[model samples]
Target: MRGELTAKGRATRQRIIEGAAAVLRERGAALATLDDIMARTGTSKGQLFHYFPAGKDELLVAVAQFEADQVLEDQQPYLGCLDSWEAWQQWRDVVIERYEAQGDECPLGSLFFQIGRSTPGTRAIVIELLRQWQESLAAGVRALQGAGLVPADVDADIRAAALLAAIQGGVSILLSTGRSTHLRAALDQGIADLRGTSHAAV
Candidate 1:
């Protein structure tokens, strides 16, 4: 559907999605209505349907994608460059800060729940988001290896997968308990273990 949009149409559609994302975050996915989104985006019903023919569900999926992208975007330069211990620490801090600020309200998670995670579009979005996130983590591990911070024999992919899992676990706990304690421990220990690998090899 997006593939067929003109530049202006794309921009308008994106505007609607972003506005809808904000509304979802503020009102929760289950409670938000198309009228709320239309008002927020200054769009009419016709305009909204023109972009998202499937109505609220379709818009929610688009908002979900936006939130998913934001999860990575919030990590910034630190996530992109983990060549040094300093960079890794920075990334850790940013990750902690982002989640803590967000508290227990996960817009992406809520959107998926409302849309049904089994839905093909929602499932693909989640899978792609995790794939990209894990790939970035793996690249960071490789960066550390290239810089001689981690031993060459260490499996970057496995290390990255573990770290990603730990982060997700911590996030799950946070969403359940509204505490960052587990998240902090997970990140601190994950990085510490990675650092330990270098010493272990020595």
Candidate 2:
């Protein structure tokens, strides 16, 4: 059922999801239970069911969406703008710092693993997240072109896609081996190569 919740209702719902995400992050999605979430959020079972009629699955999906947003939101104003080399470097630092701080506790990845392939909604959430992230990167690339930092002939979409892949690969390795060296290398080299294009075109 679609919720036409009041302003207060929306806040309460958001609180539940955020609290659930915290529980998942701390306890791991595989082990977290609805009771744990309720305790964390200070919500009763009835209140939880009111917001999530489908119970655990519905709530978990909500948490998944929350985690997806956080993946990008953590980068903040830096990701929103890449008008200069300095800005890009700041963004790269933010990315590395965010992931390193997160360490092996990948909230989104853990959510995906817990849900597995049973729910198509989870897959859709992931796809949308990647699309949005790539689009942001592409916009940054275009900004460089507009400023003549990157040659106009350079393919923004391709560059963004490749950069996104490199970041994802680095993140995977970080999760597996608990290291950020690959991530830093990928970002530094990718940005340097982009900067090189500016020199080559001149």
Candidate 3:
């Protein structure tokens, strides 16, 4: 069950969440405080609680959801439409550039690690993000198959899953090593394998 908020109330809450997310990204989740969010969002303690109700832990979960949403939103139209090899390549470059620019700071990942994924809300947010991401990749593979670029018998789900796993592995490595090489290699190999399938079918 959720509390119903007015339009203005919703806007204020979202402002707080976005502000909190920015603060968390700038200053690691472990160090960010409620007062920091207060100053960032121009909200007082009462207003913050009026919106969040359950204190900082609750606000943290909201911020986690915001960050998770950003992970997909940052990819934009490239991730949405991957029908062609050119589109896939563009998407790959975007992924690499995004992570490289982001460096070791992953707001969502940090939040999960700090709070623990065992928290039901945090677990759901991550699970949903991956599911949606994988589905988008699957859709792209199916589009290629439809266009005769990929063999009709190819399994879009499995290919998409493998590619998605490769990306996650590369991103994990980048987070640890601060280099985009693994991300680039994984993407290149995944795309090349897909291309190979096309040639094999031909």
The Cα local distance difference test for each model comes to 0.92, 0.92, 0.91
Clashes of each: 0, 0, 0
Across 1-202, the per-residue lDDT of candidate 3 in tens digits comes to: 1358888888889999999998998999999999999999999999999988889989999999888888899998999999999999999989998999988877888999878879998999989999999999999999999889999988999999999999999999998999878889999999999889978778
Location of the lowest summed lDDT over 10 successive residues in candidate 1? 55-64
Model 3: runs farther than 4 Å from truth?
1-3
> Which scores better on TM-score, 1 or 3?
1
After superposition, which runs of candidate 1 have C-alpha atoms over 4 Å from their true positions? none
The best candidate in terms of TM-score: 1
TM value for model 1 = 0.98
Candidate 1's residue-wise lDDT over 1-202, tens digit each?
A: 7799999999999999999998989999999998898899999999999999998888888888899999999998888888999999999999999999989988888999999989999999999999999999999999999999899999989988899999999998999999999999999999999999988878
Expressed as tens digits, the lDDT of each residue in 29-143 for candidate 2 is: 9999999999999999999999999999888889999999998999989999988899999999999999999898788998888888557999999889999999999999999
TM-score of 3: 0.97
**Which stretches in model 2 have alpha-carbon errors above 4 Å?**
none
For candidate 1, the lDDT comes to: 0.92
